[model samples]
Target chain A: MPAPTAEQEQAIRDAVVRGFDDQVRFLQELVATPSRRTDEADAQRLMARAFEDAGLTVDWLYGRGAGDMKGGLVANLFAYKALRAAGLLPEGRVHLQSVPEEECTGNGTLSVMQHGYTADAVVISEPMGEALVRAHLGVIWFDVDITGTAAHAQEMSRGFNALDAAFALIVRLRELEQHWNEITVGDEHFGDQEHPINLNVGVLEAGEWPSSVFDRCHFSVRVVVPPSLGSQRAWEQIEQCVEEAREQDPVVSRGHATVSRSGFFSDRYVLQPGSEAEGLLRELFSDVAGRELEAFATPAYIDSRVYGNYQDVPSLVFGPVAESLHGKDERVNLESVKRCTEIYALYMARWCGVREG
Target chain B: MPAPTAEQEQAIRDAVVRGFDDQVRFLQELVATPSRRTDEADAQRLMARAFEDAGLTVDWLYGRGAGDMKGGLVANLFAYKALRAAGLLPEGRVHLQSVPEEECTGNGTLSVMQHGYTADAVVISEPMGEALVRAHLGVIWFDVDITGTAAHAQEMSRGFNALDAAFALIVRLRELEQHWNEITVGDEHFGDQEHPINLNVGVLEAGEWPSSVFDRCHFSVRVVVPPSLGSQRAWEQIEQCVEEAREQDPVVSRGHATVSRSGFFSDRYVLQPGSEAEGLLRELFSDVAGRELEAFATPAYIDSRVYGNYQDVPSLVFGPVAESLHGKDERVNLESVKRCTEIYALYMARWCGVREG
Candidate 1:
């Protein structure tokens, strides 16, 4: 298919410029209506209205998941609306989805793919600072519970220390991290980098009094998986690491430390380096920025991974610059949002084919 | 210098029986009064009245210490009164002290000792059942502050995890506990026991969320010191362990983890076996219980450690049976209090040399 004519591209850019106010209001309102885990109903309603107003079919996939996809959903809605206002409706069907349960689970997006929501190529529109995200690392969360015998600190011999067990587990995890880094060094994707994958111990709590030996200690860890490693393979490696740790110390083994998955999992998403979707996204990004945009991978999972990996759809992540996402003072830049809309319009017309009225 | 005559003992025991109701009331009120750290004034007032009524000079040593010594103070006051009533007032000076600040600091007792309150032998009436406490362990409390570079977990390499440092420190402390136990095994007072010394990690806290690398972790620990290892020597050994831990890992070394004493220290107190004080107390206990009382060292610290170690007073812990001292439902047995009063009366007649009244 041929690229949009210069006159047509100018019309779409002008439409995006005109819709700048609405784009800002849309993003601000979307952000104001919080869509945290299991509370995305209001954000979903907002996205559905925006999509329907844009004259596109809207699908709300509901489930129990953390709602980090709201910002991306709103961006996609406004991008579609801006294009339609410019009289640049594409001939191909544009199925807009406001998916829930993508943060803690990818079942929402997975359900959408299972229900036959297919596209030649898919753009996720998650906040990526406009440098198209072609890859994202998978994540697995687990809780480690370390048990020990509690006694007055005076009777140290009678008491097995749970904090000791927790410390042992952490040492083993650090060792596992080093081994993982060494082994994944030669892979084509996510290889030979400073930190391609990571194991993070996020939260920890132990005994109550310094006068008593700790009877129980608990900690949670998040592990980033390279695209080459499946979640099952990563989990097996972690279990083996725990076993090795247990073998290294009689006290830890006696303490009965255990590790269990925390019911949250996301598979690694990688767009092939030379895929058709990658080529189109690169061209559109260069057109919008007047220069080539660099592509990079994140040690974070996005909703796009579901459609890309599960449905075999060529999916890529592209969005406006957003700072501190999922944290305090999170925001998408207004100007970038407008520029993104123009690029999305141009990409839609070229990839989906412009309809003759 | 001779043992109390059977008739004299009978008169003292009868006097104790007469004051049984008052002794019960005194202990009940003392336990009822809230004398938590830094709040011993009310309890002190009650003891002064009881001691003065018992015809003994009363001294109030003021400050913040473990209020656990109040029960022992009341028992001594009644014992002196019963002996005086039985015409068994000792010729030697019988100074009754209601000292404060034995929980967190020993300055109260230290101040009294500094003020020239002298004794041939001091028997601290702490709650230790009928057994003679000839030796007790010391205690040292310390705080560990672990510092690490804080960064988003996505950027794992840029962040040095504080929890990791904490884990390394705990591991080091466990090894120290083992080493301390081994070295203290040959101690004459607390030798070859299962646990003569101990290290307990009581309180621990780390990162706020399971999603970010922890930047700071703070925990407090309590270490028991055998009589052989003084507080200063134990502290030096602990510092050395931390230094060795810092050398083991680059992240921990870079994190600048620090260990500092928490200003609460107790030195181990051990009375020589077969001393005049020990023999007199043993004879009195055997006469009351019709059996021998065993001598053992305790992991817990007491106010008696001050008089024994600081004042050159040959102090031994001998008190009535009490359940759960310094805890909820703390109670001293009424019968034991009566029996203890009788024993104290006899000890006063024999050890202090009864005057010809």
Candidate 2:
């Protein structure tokens, strides 16, 4: 697409500033909603209403959420047929690799805002920063149990210590650090070493008295792999590695540890630079930020991947650089919100194919 | 102390067995009261009441526990005063050691039981078999927390994974497991190749979000050490080892993991063999079992150590081997209880300076 004139850009900027004010209010309203995953109905409904209000066709569907355990909410916000005819919005879900956290995702109001914007390029005012933008990261989480016996310490010979066995796995996992790059589970190598598939071992409980023979212990684990890595595959690799380390355990023939699947997790979704969506978000974001910005390649994930996984619509994450989303003093800069709103509004105007002012 | 005549030995065995019955009931009742450190008030109150019921001249006492922590109880059981005056009972807290989980140690009751016997030779009734009648093991329970950051798998470059750090510690702990030794910790090898000082790494919890970073995880650790080993010394060793391991964690360099300690446990205690108590219990138990019996050296500890440590009362562990405690289908054979009660009653009568026909 040819670039808009300065006047046209300025006009878009004004609309964006206006959008910024509206988004600020919207964000406050969304923050008020308790839309955690546990309370899915409300979040889903709110997203549906938000998209509908933004003049988009709302499709509320359900799918396997955190595996066969929890159900997932799918609120599809597509360009209305009328808008699609004008080429104002894409026909399918914009497969985004960058889905912001819900509290910051804010009722998917940005979806509504994008729906409301009849444009050739739609922008979702996410909690991301106009400062950083980029590809994707995935998360892996699971649990492992160590089985052993318990007896009076004096009779420790009669029982295997579960906690010790579990700790062996823990120790093995730690050793993985040195060979992190050497042993690849998913992606060969991402640009960022810090963001590579890394393992996390958490949780453990074990004890004994004069009686018990042996018992079980648990460890919660998480790994961050590149977008190319599927959690199941990576988990398999990790489990095997743990097994391989057993013989090396200092406590010989104590017990065994087993790994299991976890219900809660999100995978990484990458918006490869070669993709049409990635280029578009970058160009548009560069113009707004008045500086070159890299893909928001922070080692985190957004909802964009789910969309990308389900639909073919290429999407890139573009928004304000968010701060402390789930931290003790989670907050965003007031100005960043305004900037993101302007950028999003401009994106929408252009994507809608609106003529220059 | 002179060797008892056959008739006198029978009377003492009867006293020991009878007293054992009373002690078992008391034990169940005391356990039901919950004497966990967390249940200080209730535990102290229950222990106090039991001591009074057992007819001990106990004085309730308190002290600063750990690091400015408060509230501790010390029960004085002069059960031996009567026997001691008669040149039978020994003076002291009947020291012993128990693996923490099996619910085996009966410090309060044993303290009082030592009272009536007032025998220079004291025997502790743990879940130890007749083989474990003389010695056992020692341990220190710990709750370890490993802290790390959770970043989206894609953006792990920016955060820490607590699970990873914990895994590293587990590995290190296993390495240290090589230091465990049966002769040192349990006084009996039990055919284990590793040191008897077993380390268990169990339990972990991190981020609620699948892809979200988990900041912290807690590991339940049970360290088995030689009854001859001081708990504080073992703990210091453990803490130092952990410190070194934390440094080895790559996360620590990346500003991710920071480890902490927990699980304030009692000291490890073991009683010396060939002491007056050991000889007496050995002679009495063998007579009751109707054959020559071997005193088992246990890897865990019991109250017999307490007696040896505080009151210089020579002691040995003598009791039934309750197969289940603090576990599924926990139970004790009624007949064993009755038989043990007779053994305990006999020990008491012989110490009471009573001679049977």
Candidate 3:
């Protein structure tokens, strides 16, 4: 495939610079609209309108998601518009997808693939700090329930304390996290990154009365399972870790512990290097940003696995710099958004063999 | 005081044996009525009715209390009736008092003393398994609040996990409990008892979301302070323990911790032996139960502290052989209740110098 002409490339860059303000406004409107899980209708309408205005046929995929992905979704529209503003039309086909459940289950994208929407290659704007995501770790969300006996505080020894057992078990699981972090044999992508596997004790609830020993405890945790260990084996290790705590730890030994998968049982995906999609994005990012493209693995979950792992397509994940995702004052840098839009426009143009519009 | 004559004793014993059915019925009525904290009006009505039926001049002490005290309250009314049934009248005035807040603040008893209800000696039925309470531990209830920054679990290091810090601090407090338990120098009453100082993590609540690092945690604990250590010094030790945790534990160092008293800041009290009250109860218990009276220190809070510690009265805490106090199916042995009723009648008859009717 031939690259876009210098004039067309210059036109695409200039159009992105001109459309940057509107792109930010679109993103602002998206952020203003509440799109938490199971409440995405209004935001979905905005996304469909944006995709249609960019001259792409929009398919209404149904599911639940949060608004953090709206920045990337808006960037996709402006990138497509940059191509059209440059008077270029791709000779090959392109599909614009706005998926929900990317923050939770990745089921929206799975539904799209199930609905027979297949592409030769894929590009996702995932807010990766202007860097390409070579791989992402799998996430396994689990809940632990521990039951003990409640006695008056005067005789706390007569009754086992569930919170004590819970903390002991959590300490043991942290050791498992450390052990996984130490294992570097199959960690080709995430080996250099320190502490890639995190065992986060996210929520804990225990007991009811303040005068009695705690009798019951329930806690939820998110564990990052390395791609090499896989989700099944990773869960087995977690179960084994809990079993060891139950058998060994004195406090945990006295209580009853039960574990269950709570959410996000998704596997990791690696965008294998040297694919045509990767070679094109590498060239385009370097050309557009005037620097060498950097690629690294992410320790978080991403929706690229729907295509890259399950659908056997080269799904490229590259996007703008984002700070505080799912946190306080979460935001995207508009300048990085513009640079990513230029690169995305040129990559599409080159991969699809653009002709004069 | 001279012992009740054999004929008077047999008549008093027979009255208690005969009225055991009515006494149990009165206790049942009290149990059926809901009297939790501020909801004590209905139960108070039943107590007043029983006192009136037993022919005692009752003073309505308005306050809140639980049904656990109803057994002892019923015992008091029935013992007075036993004296009347035995055709005996006390030469000295006896105040049959029922007050609330015994389970929590001890304020109800405090109000009684504040109302100028002074006595020669005091006797309280605290469901002590047929054993006389020589001393009882103090109870201090406190709440701990911890706050941390919430971040995406992938970058958990950027956020301090409050649950982690809370568990770490609890572990440190448990060590302080152990240290206090090991200090035998001042634990004279509880010297032979193992783990006399109990620190119970009663209620723990932390975090809201399952995928984000926990940002906040709030927990309530019940700590038993020995009589010798005193409530003031015990609280100081707890504060010092928390301060050490904040300064030494790495996880606790990053989060903010706040401690405040929630309830039950009462000091321990020892029933000083050699008092006229102790000599009478010991002889009566040995004669009524046909066994040498057993006395031991209790690691629990009792309302006797109100009169024993504050009012300078010999507050004797002895009651029926009750099992599961403040627990499921909480009940007192009826046969033991009969024995205790006989002893209480004899003690009041002998102490108040009963005259033949």
Candidate 4:
């Protein structure tokens, strides 16, 4: 694909500068709406209107996906509007989709794909700074429950402490973390990243009273799965760890503890290096930023995995840098948002073929 | 001391049978008052009135001790009344003292002792079924504060997990428990009771958020010290254990964690097996119950430790069997209360010498 001409690039830059204020206002308004999880109805309506104003067919796929995809959705809308103003409309179709429930499940994207929305190449704007995201580690969240016999603290020998079992499990988890860190997936794309697999024990709770022996304990953990070790293999490894722990303790081995994937599970998604969509995204990022865009895998799970792997569309993640995302005072950098808009416009023109008027 | 004459024993038995109804009513009323800790004013008033009714000089030392001593207070009252009614008042002065704060500290008992409440021997009525408590383990409650750097779970290596530090401390505590249990106090008084030393991890808490690395963890533990080890030696052992743990972990060794006795501490109390108070109580229990009373040490801390060790009084715990003393549905056997009254009356006649009216 040919790079945009100097005059065309100048036109695109001029249009982005002209529409920069509107893009900022749109983003701020969308973020201010506070669309967490499935609460994205207002944000969806705003994006749908913006898509229509940019002359693209819009589909409202009401769910959590709409919230996660909002940043990407708004950036796409403004990029299209800026391209049209510069007489750089792509000849191919641009179907803007706003889906739901993508944070917990991929039902929204699935429904949109089932409803016949198809694209040769897809770009998901999940906040990943300037580098294009071609792959992400899979995630599995689970809870382990350990049960023990309760007795008076004075009769220590008569009771089993569930917190002791929890400690045993935590030790096993630490060992598992070390083992996974030692594994090399042999993926050249990951490049110098020693360990992509991580295990986070997020929440733990046990024993109601200090004087009585704890009878029950429940803990939840999130495990990051590398592309080489998919969710199934990772889960099997966790089971083996639990099995080993059970063998070391009489209370745990007496069938007093259980491990279950009751929370969330998703497969790791990786796009082959030099894939058409991935190559196009990398080139566009480089062209827009005037620097080489390094590719790397993230431990975080994103919607691109759903679209690319499940929906069978070649998808990549490219977005602005947002510090402390999903935490206090989360804010996206406005300048990066504008730069991302220009890159999206150039990619559409090159991949979809520009229309000559 | 000579045993009570058969005629005097007959009179004591008859008096106990005659006062059985009043003793039952007094115990039930005392238990019904629900004087937990500092809330013992009502129970104190009732016991003071009962002591005066029994023709004994009563001192109301108000506080938590009033609640703990209410049962003993009521039993003492009715026993004195029964003895007087049967012409069995001891020649020596019988001063009934109701002190407070015995559950927390010995301030009330100390105050009473300072105020010239001296006795040849002290008999404290703590519920121990048919056995007489001549010795008991001391207790120390302390908190360990572990501080660690807080970082996002995504960058776990940058922060020390306080929960992990807590686990390391617990492991050390378990080792200490095993070490203490192996050392025999070599007291025939305890008699084949294995593991007089016990460590209880009562309360544990750490990290507020499941997704963030825990930066702080605080846990409290209770340790039982035999009469041989005492509170000072037990505490020193705990400090040494913490120091060992700190040496093993760099995070802990950097003074990121501290162990301090912030709550409660009490020295163990043990009366010589052949002391007048212990021997007399054992004979009285055997004479009344027609069975040899067992002498054993308990892990729980009680006010007898203060009186026997601190006040220079020969004190022993003897009382009725009560299920769930400090828990819900705490109850005492009315028949045992009657039997205990008979024994107390007989002891007054034999040890203190019955006063001639």
TM-score, cand. 1: 0.68
Q: Please tell me what DockQ candidate 1 reaches.
A: 0.30
Locate the minimum summed-lDDT window of 10 residues in model 1 chain B: B58-67
C-alpha lDDT values of all predictions: 0.73, 0.47, 0.80, 0.69
Which clashing pairs does model 4 show?
A: A63-A100, A63-A101, A64-A100, A64-A101, A65-A100, A65-A101, A65-A102, B64-B101, B65-B100, B65-B101
TM-score of chain B of each: 0.82, 0.66, 0.88, 0.80
Which stretches of candidate 3 lie above 4 Å from their native place? Answer: A1-70, A73-104, A111-121, A279-288, A329-331, A337-357, B1-104, B111-121, B283-287, B324-357
Which has the higher lDDT value, candidate number 2 or candidate number 3? 3
| TM-score of model 4 (CA atoms) | 0.69
User: What is candidate 3's lDDT per residue for A179-223, written digit by digit as tens?
Assistant: 998884357888888788888888899976677776789999988
Global local distance difference test of model 2: 0.47
Interface RMSD of each: 3.7, 5.5, 1.8, 3.8
How many clashes in each candidate?
Answer: 9, 136, 0, 10
RMSD of 1: 8.5
Which scores greater on DockQ, model 1 or model 3? 3
**How do the candidates rank by TM-score, highest first?**
3, 4, 1, 2
Q: Write the per-residue lDDT of candidate 1 for residues A1-357, one digit (tens) a residue.
A: 445678777877787777767765565577677665578789788777776676431112122111234445665776676677777777778777788766556677888888877888888777687887767888888889988776556555567778777877787887887887777788666675677778888878887667767778899888876566788888888988888778877766977889999845778877877887788878888878888977887877677777777778888788767654433334556566667777777778778777534
lDDT, model 4: 0.69
The residue-by-residue lDDT of candidate 1 on B1-357, one tens digit each, is: 555677877888898888767765566677677675567788778776766566532112122111244555666787778777787657788877777766556678788988988788887787677678878888898989998766546766667788778777777887888888887777777775777667778779887655567778989898886566789988998899888888987756876889998745888887778788888888888889888978887877776777787777788788777653433334556677667777877788888777546
TM-score of chain A of each: 0.84, 0.64, 0.87, 0.79
